[model samples]
Target: MKAKLRQLFRAVPDTWKTSATIRSLLFIVLGLLIYLPIMSDVLPKTFDLNVNTVSGVTLTAPVTVEDTEATEQARAKAVRDMRPVYARNDAVTVHQLKLVNFVFKKVTDLQGQTETTPDAKLKDLKESSPFALPGDTMPALLAMPAASLTAAAQETNKVVTAVMQKGIDQNVAREEIQQQVNQQLVLADLDSRTRKIVREIAIASIVPNVTIDEEATNALKETVRRSVKPTMIYKGEVLVEKGQYISEQVYHRLDAAGLLERNASYLPFFGLAMCAGFFVLFLAFYLSQAHRDVYWDNSKILLLSSIICLTIIVMKITSMGKGINFFLPGYAVPIALGSMLIAILLDTQLAVICSVLFAFISGIVFNYESLLPVDFRYVLYGFVTGVAGAYSLGKATKRTRILQAGFLVAIINVLTIVALYLLLSSSTGWRDVLNQSVFGILSGMLAAILAIGFLPLFEGIFGILSPMRLIELSNPNQPLMRRLLMETPGTYHHSMMVANLSEAACEAVGADGLLARVGAYYHDVGKMKRPHFFVENQINRDNPHDTLAPGLSKRIIIAHVEDGVKMLKEYNIPKQIIDFAQQHHGTTLLKFFYHKASQLSETPVSEEEYRYPGPKAQTRETAIVGICDSAEAAVRSLASPTPERIEQLVRRIIADRLEDGQFNECDLTMQELERVTKSICETLQGFFHNRIEYPDDKQVAVKQA
Candidate 1:
């Protein structure tokens, strides 16, 4: 049963490697997992309550929503408080002033009638007047002297113009205007009867000059209504206290907030779905554009999805205890764990993108008492911590470096949390600050511990060669490296030179330099099988190959490639390292052995038999290692090499390989190849530069004395 279960587990990765449908399903599952935490509040928890009832428990709004009834009431009140708008009609004032002047002119004309008696003139004046006067006032005006009459008429015009200029509304009574006119005429230089007549004429002439503007009044009320904001039932706001009476207002608030029993709305679900779908699509698009290898590989896609889901799960769990008589539990979420793991096991650029995605997801999961779907505080904290972890772990070559990265992440977390608290908090408290700081520190440390524990598992299951693992394999104390050192010291030393050349060249061309270095270290472990038969290991001894037939020599020389593959497999080294041992000597002709064999046989020798059995260099690193391997051996053959010879030799090897089509399998460009050539030449020149001779210690001491 155990063996069958192991088979079952092994079959899963094979399916993932071959199936595109499974890879797409993995992304779909990731989107659903992201939507899980926010699902809790999408459909709010409802309570049974009515007006005038006592509440059993305190209820907080699960989602933000508009209180429509309350908003309407607020708008109605705003309209009621707004004052009416009025407009003045200058045309009415002008007409009233003209009538006043005309009335006085008619009085003067009637007084100038020579043939009419005073009673007839008075009757004529009354007939011509625009308004009626008191029974005795018309006769008094006619009987007055011309100077007094003119004075009264001028005073009346002045009083009418003054009263009308002060915008009298239709609501103003005529009695008020009469009283104001009486006061203005009291200082007139005329008899009391003439003054009374002037006052009545002025009062009649001053019609109401202002009127209510219905359009203006309505517009003012509308402006006031629009200025009033909608009444909102914010998320996590308390609608009713424990054991408090559910008044009509509180009951309506609960109903509007969806806390009272009602049909659930699907709008929130649709909104969350859209958000999750958009995020997933964005992540997929980023990977396809920036890291196509990960996008095309099912195992890598699965690994990325798993890490994001696991981080989100941790965040969701942390958010469950949020606001449990505390400021926040979100500070304890190890959001950086996903970023650090991706940086160590995958691409650092991908890790950076994942950090931002994780931060946003955290905001959604921990959105407590927030007006927005995402809480910016948690977003800021998560982004800072996750990015710190990723950048700090980018160059980690040792296991303990993960812990050190964790400490750095902790420091960043503490600074971020404290800064956010101080910036956002209205009333800062020392105890809450201390608690949040502690949580942040612990969160970073916990992320590190978890990363350390999970790194090996991920590497083992997915067959990934992280920098840390490659560094571990490069150690001289490893079993294969130790065997190579003890059995063939000459080959080991030669391998080190090739490692330096390969690393420099690969780095110059934007390839994996560390992988190239590690691969170069074990590239020649096959030479240890028959140490003395190879040229490098044969010290102080006659050449064994000179005694043997050329064909026999060729067989022994080519056996190392096959022998290296067998031994590396038995030792369980990573396949990437083994590829170096296998493919570094691609299918180029072994011309030295082939020429010697052809000279002895008196016939043409088959070039295929003398060539290394190869699938060719399948990656830039392997191709670069192949070039460096040949270049190093060639330069070392010179008795005394110079910079010119080293440059010529490196370029020749690269040109020969390119002409032979050995680099056709990899995506190495000519520009990259040229860069590799330059880099290799510079490195070899440093290695083989001339050195000055030094005096012996005894001679130096004698000269000094």
Candidate 2:
């Protein structure tokens, strides 16, 4: 049954990971897609740029015209003729006068048309089409203005195609089409005054100087000419005829009316920058992945992500404070990336490199203009804040500390702003200083708050285990440790002693003393499952060993190491601590059992079976524990522990363990072993500080020893 269960659990990992990988890939693609459109540029920078313009750009008339009054007359004629017609009456009436031979024929016998309804009217269209009028068919069509008629006529493809395909030469056909269109427009009836008022409206428009590639320009020109000129009026009189004067208002009016066409590819270029920038950021994240650590894992990936987010935020910020031309003396890039440097990367040295990169990026983004020198103060600000942030919060950082560091950064940012302003601006006023100072202070706090807020997200995203999280987990109130203490007090006490010795030895050897201590605290947690089997908690009681035979005793006790490993697994304790529990008692002889077994039966029973099954101590901390656990028990067993005897006993036990090959797996040097021996002797001396007595001084010791 147990073997079957193990086989079942083993299959879960592959299935789980394969599904997770596929899901993660999908989300990554989705996120990348959504993020691209918001990048620097892709769509038109100004929506107005794509609008069809309503006026020309040439306000500069031909030099051949030389009269101010002629310009005025020309302007008056333009305003009168070009004004759009409006209907103030109760009903909208259509005008149809002098219908052309082509227009009439196209509606009937010219082409394939059995029914009047065009474009195959649907149910919805059938109700909405003007041809489905309330009255009888062919009510007298009211005459309409030429411009409106021409615009509507643009949809008359049959008429236009007929004119083009006629046997007439191209030039002659075009001229005839124009003249025929004008005659039809003139005959279209309206109030006499309305017709007279709109007599000189010209059909000219303004196109901007677009700097597109040849193909795009040609296509644009074709589209504009067809969409605009084909829908214009050419009747009665020409407004702003050949010699009209154009004013700034007219130019602006035309520009607003969809006549503007400036074809610059600045938009796509900006989008390209945005994509490149994000790609660079992701690349930085990839390179920084090598530095990720556990309990020490924050890396350049976190810093890079932070910078990317901050760069976007600062760009938005600068946009809000528009017209900062050089006003931003420094950029926000360095501060953001640098702030995350210490917690993630673990190397303060690499932080400055990040800062320089951020500085350059900030200068590009936050710098006020394309021309003139960038005030460089933003770069300086970014570099300083980043370096300072990284250095300040590099190790053992808590959330509050990260935030406090940001506040300190804020102060520095303010100072930097003030200094830069004083150095570069003219007549720096108190108001200006105050504003800059406030902005700097706010920015700094934001940096700190943002960093603190994002740390957990990064931790989860990158599988980073931070020291702060480890410390919190190590706290005694944590569920696992608390259970150990409450359910297995003796094991807990023994673990504590081991922790102290190991921590001290680890510190003495320049190792991670905290990790050693934490590991030690939980190393023997498995003993809790069978606490009474150990002698540490056998206080005020007879020796259980007296009742049990040596072989059974050795087996029961030797089994604790394996038992501990089982317990560690059940609790899902980390591998490092489990290693200590398994190896602290190396495969050494349990001599007391072998001696007893020999006395009972001299048939040469193997001593190897009585020993522990171990791979031995593999680190200084585990080795220290093995020595200390024995030293403490041995010293406690002595009936009379004089200082010299205790020292001798400590040395002998250490020697026995050493020769038994107990410390072989660990990297403890001879010098370190001697130090460990001295340290134990010294610590024991403190614990057993009751005064020594001479032969005659047993009675006197109570009074004066």
Q: Could you say which candidate leads in lDDT?
A: 1
The residue ranges of model 1 lying beyond 4 angstroms of the native Cα positions read 1-26, 45-262, 427-430, 541-556, 600-604, 642-644, 690-705
> Per-residue alpha-carbon lDDT of model 2 for 1-705, expressed as tens digits?
443433454344544433535434433443343245334322222223222233232222211112333344554454444423222211111111112323323333312333534334233233433333223211211133345334334423323333223322312443454554344446545444333222211110001112224555455544444343111211111223223454554433333322334422445455545544565555445444644331122222333444445545554555444335334333333255344534443455555555665554454445442222233766677777777776667564366776777777777877887787778678577677777777677666767776666555544433334665546547899777898888778778777776776677667766666667777777667667666767776667677777888888898888878887887667545455677788777787888888988888869879788888887887787777777777777777788777888789889988998887787767788788888788777777766667755657667786785
C-alpha lDDT of all candidate models, in order: 0.85, 0.54
Worst 10 residues of 2 by lDDT: 200-209
**Backbone clashes under 3 angstroms, per model:** 0, 31
| Per-model TM-score on C-alpha atoms | 0.68, 0.51
Tell me the alpha-carbon RMSD of every candidate.
Answer: 7.5, 25.2
**For candidate 1, lDDT tens digit of each residue in 528-590?**
888898877889988898889877887887888889988986786777888999999988888
| Model 2 TM-score on a 0 to 1 scale | 0.51
